[model samples]
Target: MDRAALPGGVLTGLWQRARLVERRIETPTAVTLVLAPAEWPGHLAGQHADIRLTADDGYTAVRSYSMSAPVRDGLVEFTIQRVHDGEVSMYLCDDLPIGADVELRGPIGGWFVWRETETRPVLLVAGGSGIVPLQAMIRQRRAANSDVPFRVLYSVRTPEDVIYGDELADSADGVETTILYTRTAPAGSGRPPGRITQADLKTHGWTPGFDASCFICGPTGFVETAAKALVAMGHDSHRIKTERFG
Candidate 1:
């Protein structure tokens, strides 16, 4: 898309060279890469970048990854989860070295973003690495010192699968996170291991009458289930935004 058609009018379709400045391991299967694009006009919290990688034989692959944090000194961060047998993810998670250069085009997507001016209570639901963009939202909230209330329900297979574990635990005021273990519950856990049910939303999410703005991101099946549950509980479908990856 052209710049006029791009979200926020801050991105272009042309791919720019970006260099990896930092890398951090988020989980066994995920890694966070900080890249400094030659030029960046800034982006919304929930936007993403299309990363292009080329091989020695001239084969190229492109994939989209949500930003895990807000822009800092023109640097952008992406937390990528390695998909089994997936070339792009595997390379990004394991082989992409610091100081290497890659092609990036984005700050793409607009509908799923969160703005600081919003006053409605926010409900964020994420499954697995879907928490990346939502984490950017939380960081933006803190950075802007906006007191918008936020409630997060994060689903993972086990404790080790939770990304940004320490940061989520130490969230600022007006933010809260509830972790739901789908396959393994930790010791002394009161709840049994299970998928997120309507009951879970009712307990951890805003009341239907609160008119909260809901953002759900995850695998396709998980996102669908959560959206359906929220709708069944009377949340306006328009107020519930979703971003899914598989």
Candidate 2:
């Protein structure tokens, strides 16, 4: 996944607006947008793009959003969470309409991507909307028919705030998943309702000798805490990769 070559001619065509081809409401707080570039350039899963828009007063705002669609998919999909007081998110969620056009540059970012050749077992940890990039990775792996073992530990404020809840649950039927709810109990199920901790990891059979490569993406503090916990459990730092969202 070469970041420099991504976006191709689209990078030079920033002044031109890319049309929104599709949109889906993922949850009360998030929406997924599918954009078709006037000219489509390939993008890798787990990579992100920069969307820029100019207001009537000539004020320009830009934001980076991770690609939600699998890399093999031709269109670009962005799963965006609405952020209160965020200039770009507010406009995208409240104002952007179907068939609207916006300036975008990328298929950028490399560090977050899992290249196709990677076959090691993967452990993904995400919080809230941070699951976007990891979703891409999971889809990529499934698309490739790769036999890699992968699992996800997704923490959210509550069941209501769990983005991609149904999809993730269905996907977990074939892959492992541990949902941690910080503000709500595990509804109906007898599973313990609490934040992730060392005991939770141990109970889930996550141990040092699993030969798994860990990828953690979430709010900065949660990611740091999870990483430290994994490290304390004797997982190699080199085997752990992380992306933090503020």
Candidate 3:
């Protein structure tokens, strides 16, 4: 039997150990880790994994982080932001050693995931670090070489806080990315800094008639407001999927 199989030969799919193979500092508060699990079954974009860590005294801590990019060669990527009061996140972003093993399980979460087979026009809205999962969907769309039109509306406090900003800016080939700076905009950008308003949605988003698949992720308030804006614009509620973070 293979290692993925249960010890009783039950073929049970369960949590397996994963080692952090690489880590990239995305920003002052955020970092992305590339991990290889011993029994990975592969994962869809936007799915998340729960990581488990144990202290020397047997105190275990677990936290879940969504996949930041499409699965590749069994390597799962998770982008984590450090919450000053969050123990797990603090460890992940500040002190976790490279090559250390952590217990991980998942590919969990079905509702928010984006499979490569989706062929319709794709719309993604992200606020703050919520871009992580949506970015995964974007990567999946590209990796599939599908001609599905992609659009992203990324809202950030300042130009410096945009996660994956360079890649988002370079999306001129087939994807369009719009930056909404709530606190400040880069010099030379004429648009005033503001929150995502109804007008902004109507201007940059798909109409209800287009039947585009929309994915919105952000803080609870941002997600709620964006989702409502889509609904008010006659978008079918069923076509919009939302994932909210703190």
Candidate 4:
């Protein structure tokens, strides 16, 4: 077997023992855990990791969660949402205590990452908890003081359901954010609450011919719909990349 042909995780296994140093409640169902890996090779914005949890009886549950920000002072953070029936998610979000140990591997997928060198205008679309990795891009851009003009279209159930709400709000000056509430809207939002539509993308996103790079992360349906819409609006199909979840 060719070593070069080996899968990334197999070649550079991220498997390591890590300690949970901090935790933040991002939302009712989501929590961000800051882990200090004994050995971290570092990671890019939009990368994710595989977390494996073991029970006292030796049963194990494995799940992948996105890195919520660029590596900060040798610490990597994951913002995980509780999936009631998902054993791994449930433990990470609810049962796991600060200072506990867990097995982890990654900075996983490579194709979904964003680089700081690209100067073209960017358009980021996220839905629900899919905002985790995308938020890393926003943070990296700000940290580098890169003048890469970008905008975010975040769709959520309601204002209260928005994670990193205040941070996004405060950083709105450089990168614009348009929140579409599917279930309800806050008072005086003017327009009735709705899902993100073609009109919203056109008005708030880059025009099809603007040479903007589009990154959309969300449920499979949303990604397909948004990708198709971008192509239909004259954007180059190759320039639109997506990361989809259930």
Instruction: Specify the highest-lDDT model's number.
Output: 1
Off by over 4 Å in 2: 1-16, 71-73, 171-173
Q: Give one digit per residue, the lDDT tens place, for model 1 in 1-246.
A: 001122343454679999999999988988999999999878898988788989999999888788888899999899988888888888888888899999999878878899999999999999888899999999999999999999999999999998999988976587999999999999987889999999999999998899999999888899999999999999999999988876
TM-score of 3: 0.92
- Model 1 poorest ten-residue lDDT run: 1-10
1 or 4, greater by lDDT: 1
lDDT by residue (150-173, candidate 2, tens digit) is 788888887878777777786543
Ranking by TM-score: 1, 4, 3, 2
Q: Per-candidate RMSD vs. true structure? A: 3.5, 4.2, 5.6, 4.3
For each candidate in turn, the TM-score is 0.94, 0.88, 0.92, 0.93
Off by over 4 Å in 4: 1-11
Worst 10 residues of 3 by lDDT: 1-10
Local lDDT at 63 for model 1? 81
In model 1, the runs with Cα more than 4 Å from the true position are: 1-13
In model 3, what is the error at residue 232, expressed in angstroms?
0.6
Q: Write the per-residue lDDT of candidate 4 for residues 75-129, one digit (tens) a residue.
A: 9998887776876777777778888999878767777778999988999999888
lDDT of each: 0.88, 0.75, 0.82, 0.82
